[model samples]
Target: MASTAITTLSGGLVSVQASLQSRSKTLGLNLSCSKSVSAIRGLKVASNVQIDSSFLGKASNSSLWASVVSKPEEKQVFSSQLQPQASFKVAVLGAAGGIGQPLGLLIKMSPLVSALHLYDIANVKGVAADLSHCNTPSQVLDFTGPSELANCLKGADVVVIPAGVPRKPGMTRDDLFNINAGIVKTLVEAVADNCPDAFIHIISNPVNSTIPIAAELLKQKGVYNPKKLFGVTTLDVVRANTFIAQKKELKLIDVDVPVIGGHAGITILPLLSKTRPMVTFSNEEVKELTVRIQNAGTEVVEAKAGAGSATLSMAYAAARFVESSLRALDGDRDVYECSFVQSELTELPFFASRVKLGQKGIEAFVSADLEGLSEYESKALEALKPELKASIEKGVAFVHKTAATAAST
Candidate 1:
């Protein structure tokens, strides 16, 4: 006979209810079958046996209360019941490139990822295959060549594009516009189709131009979420912290320098005055630090002596941004990181600043950094708007033209 029991383990109290088989047997048989309580420490088994021999067999069946430990599926169900639903699946487009490979590895290390998808025109199979060996729970999928771009993007929560040609010594982001612009546009089109709601992070440089290009393409697709798109400008902030600490004889880990404005030359504004735990600097020191931060990329380009431009450091910076986004996705209450995004913080169409990240992305823009710009910075900030605006317009125009042609065909 089957019996149900509710037992209090702490006090060793076991209460059981059983529907006993009422046979035409004598009253002595029923009295002798008084439920046996097996004093098992972990599981309490109270058995109501119908027959003499079968009573012991039923008492041994204590699997249900054997241990309160849960199976994987049961644990998952319990966890989901306790926590809110998870959101955000980060995608790395061009995950095979120099920056993308290392960046992809770092992102896979994050606990916030539910799924990671990799897209590239070549060699991505090897990249994905290598990353899949990692112990992290994130599942990596690779899409090779243009044909598979759509599949790579489908259901992505956050799409990061680091897919573009590296900058040569003499070339500006404008020089890269001819080629990288086309690459960014094609991939973003797939994103619009497959995962329109995903937060888009642009790491392909001329980020100053490519970010604008990304915005324009999304606008054309009619799925533009201004808060959802970002240019990964964490590299500038990384450089600022490194350089400021080195010069001032301060600890690098403690220094926090806020780099603002556009990502390129003359436009890249490092707010020296805003350095945390506030240190006062002389006029010459300020000028030197500003120049160093602005030309740090060029310094790397020159120092590599013709090998490459800032791949390792840039990868680290990009990876850090990926972590911040992941943390926000994991239902973190206050995840804020510096990024370049479409903003009205300044007159510029897009500005790089610290933004609070949430479920919907970009919860609040940190304009506190811009409140007390030096006179020199105020002038520089104003001057950057027109050039930045023009660059944005150029990108918007290019996508409109390309999209128009595709529609016609």
Candidate 2:
């Protein structure tokens, strides 16, 4: 009786094991191997099996695959290494200043950036050394003072100029023109001499003036590409998005307000009707939002209690512009941002509006839905023109006047 029972038990156990193996094969599962891995190879499988901790290493990780598979389109959730692409070099002039450090950090975070060159008149080595500790792939190098400016700019695909004095409390951007203008002229002259083909982004204060000054200098050097120069007006759009989202209780990511004209007080006009995910607004809401967007920089200045200006936000905006430029250089046609550029969208020589970015820089200027604008927006746009025109003339005049004096000398 004992012998018969033993034989029957062995036969049943063999049959059950065989059934499991056959079912696994039909389902395209191979448990016959005696190896461990961190992930399954080129497959997405879900299983509820409790893998032995010791079996979760070496040859295969299929034992660690969790839950039952239900979807065919599941992507790979593996621990395989990723291949890194070749890098682009980005140089930030004035990398030691309030804006430069943060902007450098952000640019360093870009996987596309292979090298970052930081330049300043003083204290840039420390900033470069500190940033170099980040485990990112971009190599950080510092070039100090005017003598090294060319070296810093050489081989750079994008050169960002934020090298100038910032606005103080109770001071208008115009008050910054004299000093910042000279600083911009000097730095841009170097950019023209060295990396003439690099995309130039001006972030210095009085950008309305500085950008024109830079453009004139580039033209003088005989390497000017109007499509390649940009005044960083992204901050205006960023503020508009934030302010609109606030009043409408909409997501910030979904808010889209086109801020055109120059980047100063009344010149920064935010057209709210063209807002994405469309929402209606009363006349009062329109007035309130527009005013708030125009003066958002001043809002930050006041909030800082005279300690400093909007360095953090400006850095963020500048970083965004640089990334867009890099993507454009990488041949992405979908990248677009509001930038103060040489445009025929208005009577002014330079205007800020949404522009498509491409490998050659400003791909095309985007026309805002002006015809559909609210009455308030239409009137506001007309009102902003005089101030915008004056600011544009001021920028152009500064460059021409300076050049005349230099030629006469």
Candidate 3:
């Protein structure tokens, strides 16, 4: 048997030697390893020693492996700690799109997700089949066409809609909204009919508008739950954290920036003055960072040369939001994330800011972050109101127009 010694700051040098054999009945893998690092915490072995079996698993079963795998039945007990049980069904709309496929794969890997339903109008079956082969605990199901959409949402605890058209270079928001708004309307209706109580995450572009579109459709269906609706603006926050960390030479993991306002253009606001661990930014630095964060989507789209939009990063951010939402539903009290939802934080009907998530959805909004905005941020906040309000009204108006047209027909 192989042995490895790991030196911890407090534990000095500790030697670990073990021959481990574990079986994951779901994936049907015989996991055997001669050496493993169980745990080292405060000179004592902590029960949760995450194992990396990426290279150890068979080629066919490799997709099933998690970066951190904890087996509780090992003969040499490292510790008694175990992660919380996995419990939640997450449905991903537009699972075949640029963002949706990767989003489905990420969600499929989550131990908290018990079932992942992938729904798209076309080519979703292959996406589902491919994701189903992963060794993760979640069961993957694909739903194709409008006929199967309701079935996909049925019994879901969380419904994430990234299912609209991606923004291409030179495409106006109205052009994007005209196409995506209809898609969102159709999908939100399905969610209302099948999973009215499921936490709805609207990731479709022009989110400032689509979110209102979703809200109105849900209201039409008599299933609108303000607390359960969320517009995933996590990408703005993710971009802000990354850019700020790089510019400030701060540890990325230690940095947190709250992005408020809407999810597009000038509407995305990164509250840099309020960044955790409190970093100072020159006025020029603040302006540059805010512009970059606001236009990060366009930056990616231009870089991709219209090949695609910000699919991967958007997928990652959506996954982060999904995980946070799941954690909140799992009763983890510390879960907080920035999301666009029905709000009174500003005069707008909807806004994006840091929110305390709970089992019942958004439990509270962190309004203090908006209290003391810097001069530039305050001015930017005021400047964005008109555009953000216009987007919200556009979405709300689209719903009413469609309804009126249908009634006339």
> TM-scores for all candidates?
0.76, 0.79, 0.83
> Whose lDDT is greatest here?
3
Candidate 1 structure, TM-score to reference:
0.76
Candidate 2 overall Cα lDDT vs. reference?
Answer: 0.72
Model 3 per-residue lDDT tens digits across residues 56-148: 443221112222333444323233322225478999999999999999988876556778999999999999999998755578888899889
Q: Which residue pairs collide in model 3, if any?
A: 64-135
Q: Which stretches of candidate 1 lie over 4 Å from their true place?
A: 1-88, 169-174, 404-409
Clashing pairs in 2: 36-59, 36-60, 37-60, 37-61, 46-67, 47-67
CA RMSD for every model? 17.9, 14.4, 9.0
lDDT on C-alpha atoms for all candidate structures: 0.70, 0.72, 0.78
Clashing pairs in 1: none
Count: clashes, candidate 3: 1
Candidate 2 lDDT by residue in tens digits, 108-128: 766568899999999999999
- Candidate 3 error regions (>4 Å): 1-84
State the lDDT of candidate 1 residue by residue for 182-249, as single tens digits. 88888888899899998888988777778888888788789999988989888888888878888888
Report the number of backbone clashes for model 1.
0
Best model per TM-score = 3
